[model samples]
Target: MTIAPSDSALAPALRGYADHKPDHLARLHKIEGQVRGLTRMVDDDRYCIDVLTQITAATHALQEVALGLLDDHIRHCVQEAVRADQDTGETKYAELTIALRRALRL
Candidate 1:
């Protein structure tokens, strides 16, 4: 889900990944191409192991993007919130913990 800053009072004026948004978009586009390739491979009845390998590659790429975003969030968004106030600090940290759990699939 895409949330604009206007959508939430707590939202930052600029996103954590703003500085590297272009890089992220490029990575996402590459991942999109990888997914399309995987679909084509399946349509062509390619070997099972090859398809799985491509799937793994795509998954890892996505995970890398996720990690990069997460790192940016910590360095920018969460840090700013914490520096602003104690309540916001606690809130952001809790939110970060939840996000980490979800990322880890714990």
Candidate 2:
């Protein structure tokens, strides 16, 4: 079997998430604000449970962003790689699995 270059090795004109990038950034910005709020909460000696709740919200927000990006990666990058060739497709799928492992902290 021949190894093929990964889709991620080359940059495409537009990424799968290109169209939704603005929305993604907006959500990230909101998460950033949530982080800043957490900082303030700690500094102000806010209740422990409240801080935990905010942390959970922030974590959930980040997870949502991640899920969106993952979906885009599969739909665009993986699909393109598979279209290129079976070897490239398999490579991309393996790469995605490793990435998911890291993301999920498994």
Candidate 3:
């Protein structure tokens, strides 16, 4: 089961996010530049295939960031939860499982 962000008591779990804030910011900045380049490509009437190739590269880069964040969450947050207790730890594990499923689009 998925807990909606607005409904959850947990205040936006971002353990991994906080840990990698600088890295994420840097990657996002690069992605922003790529987006600007894509916009310029469109505005300058570049070839459709070239623009699409850029788009694909940008998407893959974003996915890499996402996977890294997810890994950190599992290694830090989820691991802590499981180590802390059994009952609620199980819940945390379930929560992480759901997250992994969603991340993997399973």
Candidate 4:
């Protein structure tokens, strides 16, 4: 159930800025390795508790990445929208609400 951004009159508040820094990329790569390790754990019939712990760590890492991106969005895009008197800020807020709901599987 992918939720794409609506193409309304409001300009998109989320724009592609600079690419991820080397450190960020390295962190993501490590997370990817962790995910692969989980797959290997399942294949090797590892204990359930161990797998669950790895999953918890992976979830935290992903959440950290998300929060960083959200902070950037609030600082740059959302702030600009509010200053320009554009509808983008409200739309962005709604988008954030939907994203949180989806992320939490609520």
Candidate 5:
């Protein structure tokens, strides 16, 4: 199969999630608050361990968001694309493997 630089079919199809953007925004806002709290902890001369703990929590929160987004992509974007064209299963599988590798690196 010819590997195009872009998945034109999936790109347009995946943009149909306008119904639940508020949920994503809410998660982002929570993460934002966590970051702000971390900043304040540093500014207030909090203990090193306390600051590190908050940092870990914020990192985990970010990871959770990333995982959620990835799951959505797999369930919706990749699922639809593969269903639309059965031959794309290999290409989509490769893409998921690459994404999983990057996530693992973090």
Candidate 6:
């Protein structure tokens, strides 16, 4: 099957994914606030363990956001590629593998 990059079939789904930007930004804002709180915790000489725990929670929250985006990309872009009878699954898999490796620092 010949694949054309200009596939209109995927546009709507991609747009839907783009529409998620604002919500993602809002989540980042909250995460930013958590970071600021963490800074203050350090300045106030809060318990070391408590500060560490907050850092862990913040890391997890950020990971959750990243995972959400990855899932959306797979559902939209990757799925569209597959339906287009292109080797989109393998392409997306490789892209995601690289992304995961970078994000996880592995």
Which ten residues in a row are the worst by lDDT in model 1?
A: 1-10
Predicted model with the maximum TM-score: 1
Candidate 4: worst-modelled 10 consecutive residues by lDDT: 13-22
How many residue pairs clash in model 6? 0
TM-score of 6: 0.73
Residue 36 CA error for candidate 5 (Å)?
A: 1.4
* Per-residue C-alpha lDDT of model 2 across residues 1-106, encoded as one tens digit per residue: 3345455667778998998899999999999999999999999999999999999999999999999999998998889989999978898888788769878982
Residue 32, model 1: Cα distance from true site in angstroms: 0.1
Model 1 spans > 4 angstroms off: 1-13
lDDT of 1 by residue, 1-106 (tens): 3222232667557788999899999999999999999999999999999999999999999999999999998998889989999877777887788789899992
List all candidate RMSDs to the true structure: 4.2, 2.9, 2.8, 4.6, 3.1, 5.5
lDDT value, residue 30 of candidate 5: 98
Report, for all candidates in order, the number of backbone clashes. Answer: 0, 0, 0, 0, 0, 0
> What ranges in model 5 sit over 4 Å off?
1-10, 13-20
Indicate whether candidate 4 or candidate 5 has the larger TM-score. 5
How much lDDT does candidate 6 score?
A: 0.77
Model 4 lDDT per residue over 18-99, tens place? 3444556677898999999999999999999999999999989987776766666666656776777656667666666776
Taken over the whole model, the C-alpha lDDT of each candidate is 0.88, 0.89, 0.81, 0.73, 0.78, 0.77
Candidate 2 least-lDDT 10 residues: 1-10
Model 5: per-residue Cα lDDT over 33-102, one tens digit each: 9999999999999999999999999899889877877887788767877888876866777777777889
Query: What would the per-residue lDDT of candidate 3 be over residues 1-106, giving only the tens digit for each residue?
Result: 6543432466565665688889988998999999999999999999999999999989988988888888887887778778889865677777777877787872
Better of 1 and 4 by TM-score: 1
In model 3, the worst 10-residue window by lDDT is: 2-11
